[model samples]
Target: MTPEQNRHAAQLAFVASGAELNIGTPEECPLPVDQLVATRGDEPYVRERFSAGLTAHVYRIHAQGQDWTLKLAREKCKVQNVDGQTSFLNEIQRRADLRHLKHDPLLTDRLSAIVDTRYASFRHGVLLSPWIEGVAIQAWDERQLLQLFDTLVALLLGGLFEWDLCTGNTLDDGQVRLFDFGYMYRFDPLRAFNSNGTAMPQFHAAERFETRQYFAHLLRLEQDGERLALDAFTLEKRIAVEAYQGLRAELASRGAAPVVLDWLDGIIATWKRALVNDVSELYLQEAWRSHWLDLHDDLSGQTCTPSTLARIGWLERTARERYADVQRLVVVESKNRLFDQLREARQLAQRWQVA
Candidate 1:
């Protein structure tokens, strides 16, 4: 069939299959993969992949003329929930609304236009956006790391600012770039006060521990007796940990990970001592020094130290165990809740048709 004919057929099939129709002309929507490929004569290469949080297959297209990412949703059936599609559309609308806002030099730039393709499949939708390039802030080098922390603090304290300021959502080139604004909100003092009631913002213990490792690395980059630029990182880490600890404690009291709660409390104590005493810089310096001293001690055979290989193995095993538990729980819950809802809807529709 011709390109237009093929698209028309797809649209008809989607509608017949009971997919919700999107409000837009065909030209406004993202063309089918075949149509897109046919239109792009020799521009960029396209590779389809999937991300952890998406039900859609994502296509990363690289062209000298055009660089963009395309996501096409998987086909849904009567037994499948389309909440993912709804969430994607909501996120698109939110991003579009904030597209005109002046972004911090640290945030990733997103394109304003969202190409919707709700008629692409029998029960799915599609979206397209520009692909950003950079390593995550967690993986940045010392110079990049300093800039990243600075940028984060500036963004947070500038005005009413709210975004998931986690390591995963931050990217760094020479400067930091905040991405994934799906949970962005305006920072309200009232809300903050109501939530924590005079508690300072802090990092979760896990985040603090992870960031401490990064800080140690940064300390190593400096010469002897030279101070590392870590004021913002230290402050933000403390804030995030405090917030995380409070949340974790609440969860733990309800029979969550009590072990994690204890660990977080210890970390919080450490941060309080370091920050309140204005000795955070010294604390990081000492931690790094102790680490290097232990390394030297290991080399001198004072004790049989765990090799890097052994440490990695331990970490991998721990991750696997936790992930398996999480995966099983998620799969069971999703099937019971989301899939059941869809199945009930389909049964209702069938009964109505029969009546």
Candidate 2:
């Protein structure tokens, strides 16, 4: 089939399957393919096949003389009561908002303008936006990797904290542009604490909570100071710390050195101070401050050796030990609580039996 024909068929099949068709040309049964080509332009070249996604088939296209990616909902996903319309609108709004926020230095540059539309009888909803181009932050080399982390920390403190910043979500394009703002929120550290001592920010709550937890874990690791023996009480936290430490170890083994590790330590320390001060900008400033760059320079050209790798392993093992200790403590406390509850239950049962 001609490209235009295929585009028409895709749109028709999408709408026929009950999708909330949002992007297609009207007045045609299957929608004209020429219209699709005209709408998107002929630059990036339309991907002939759909790219597999979690809930939809995405197509890479050059739309309006720019590199764009489009997503069309799968027919099977268009269930009754599914608010596909609302979701489509919300996504468009969110993308628009993101484009506004992209002007901030912390955000990645916008690749293509987001377009939301429906054509003809196409039922499936469509989302078109600029395709982000860059390497995943987690895939960077040691020096570049450390720099990426520094950028993330800076962005977090600079009022763009996504609460969901992780290895999986960050991309490096000279700087980091965080994607998946479905849970993005603005956070104020000072105004975040509730009466119960819980921190509640208006952003991605779960992600924020996890980030705080991980930071707290790091603080605990620092406090341990020496190679401390692990107990059941600290096992879980230790394990969490070990996971990060192990990752660091792997990176070091691949060529990261003491100076880079030290730079990381400084970043962690600055982050801790920022957390304590409830000031995000302070952390960002520290990340880019003169002293930090000097440290970066000092670490430059340093490569991880076998000795450093061994040291990282030792650090990870120590963290694991602490985790074991913490876990044991938790288990003991749980048992004690359970025993008390069981005793009370037995007493209540005895009284009922007697009655």
Candidate 3:
């Protein structure tokens, strides 16, 4: 869609999403637009700048007698390509959908784990929310994994798919909170496994976390010892298997199509078996897949972060040291071509590292 269309849809979606709650409006917002844009850093009203955001300038401000997050859209998003250019628009669209979900009492608390948008103006390029005082997710504990999968399961059942679960997008302060929606999109959960449909059944809630966040952490721990890394994956898988089983039953009762239920069943079964029998094999297979898939995503978006560089290193080291193991798992179509592409991506990543 055109940029104008993107902004319009996002604004309308935000409005429609919040219609039931009447959360707050721009008119009620305590931050004056002129003063907000003019204030360089913490005003008597503002506290800190969260410069890590890509498409917007985010600041922690106190307004309306409480602390809040105020985001102003950047004229040009620093992300390199189209997705980056439109991320703010897309974020509001998804945020609108997520905020609207709280109307259902059963879903209210479950989806409340998602960040709440107090006010947004796509045209004016500003968004507001209560400030989340939390720590960035650096390590995955059992509770964190379970909490994350719970949020994912809820979103999936509601037909919303979150494409980005990067560490920066998640936080923990007694509970996991998802605050970013730039890559989240809608789909018919009953009709499809994910936004990709049944074509890529492997990309589900558990797999997405493993790919986007967990395995990257495992890669870091690889140097400590294989045992530490394997222990981490095992812990995550056990939690995931239970989470998927819960998801499966929920969808089945909701009258989801057999295809969707069966797809989830198969994943749950593999994870179950791996957990019961031995998890080492499953760990290798998933680690290989997660790292490889994430590499392609980073390359596709032309947004390589330090994790991108780490994933590339993991691929190169694995190909060199464990080509036989990958062949045994049959993780790729062709080993030689995969290695060639990895080398090519390595070169590109050096230059395209997202600033």
Candidate 4:
């Protein structure tokens, strides 16, 4: 195995077998852990119960004259996978680290949208935060994109890589708010693209956003057909490219490695060329990648929703229709191999489709 793969393997093993999750202090929480756990179904204190979160049971508790979000870890997470199994523990770790940054004014300012963790304990299986009043983002305007990019740039520069940027994890109140940290992990920003260090170049901040959120939105736009979708993607790419230019300069000023700089330059160059030249092909390539990757994630997690089915159906239909394009332009070791992978993905989706 490659050195990076070996290291990740070691980490997964370590995290899986590590010490019991730490207990968070009850002081941070308005209610004691025992009492909180006791107060359940139809409890007057819980104003709303949100059962959609994959890792935890979420509730809006109206107690102590304030609205608070109470997240209790599931005994078994809905997504039956290793990532799901360890996410609660992972969240606890990230929260602890973020809490340490609370005292720094600069860090606090940059992390304004990140929710204040009132209490979190892996052992207690609960997390508490001041309830944020916001709505899930239905559209990406320039303002929203800029705000998200700022936070992302800050996080990337500060060594945190958030792997999950799906819709539920973000909400828009006047500004974008990010609450979930279950998939945010630390990495050396100066030397690496993400949490796995220099291991995976294919996965980056922009790619994560595209794969998780943007492309799905594009899929919605596709009902209007190519012009609107391409227009939307082109706008997003322009913003992303601008954001990345700033990121490159900041990282470079902070003594980022040459390899990292080169990667950024390459991305910037590609996007700039697309903006100046033909952007349709770029959009097509990224859309295919985004859909394909998301389908894989759903299959692996055994959380294949209707959206996953849509992604699979799109791929299956598109691959046959646009075989020449997928085979010619899609960067894969072998066209035959990619076709095999797609078939395998279809089979897995059939087996693992959630309801």
Task: Give the Å shift of residue 220 in candidate 4.
Answer: 0.6
TM-score winner among the candidates?
4
Better of 2 and 4 by lDDT: 4
- Cα error, residue 293 of model 4, in Å, equals 0.8
Q: Compared with the true structure, what per-residue lDDT tens digits does model 4 show for residues 80-169?
A: 766677788878788877776656675678778788887777766888889999999887888898889888887887678988899889
lDDT (Cα, 0-100) at 68 in candidate 1? 61
Report, for every candidate in turn, its global Cα lDDT versus the true structure.
0.40, 0.37, 0.80, 0.82
Task: Tell how far residue 119 is off in model 4, in angstroms.
Answer: 0.6
RMSD of each: 17.4, 18.8, 4.1, 2.5
Best by lDDT: 4
Candidate 1 lDDT by residue in tens digits, 26-75: 45434444554333233346654434333444566654355566555544
Estimate, for each residue in 10-91, the C-alpha lDDT of model 3 and write its tens digit: 6557545743322357577777666665655657877888777778988899877789888888888877665677677777
Task: Please identify model 4 stretches exceeding 4 Å from their true place.
Answer: 1-24, 332-344
Which order, best to worst by TM-score? 4, 3, 1, 2
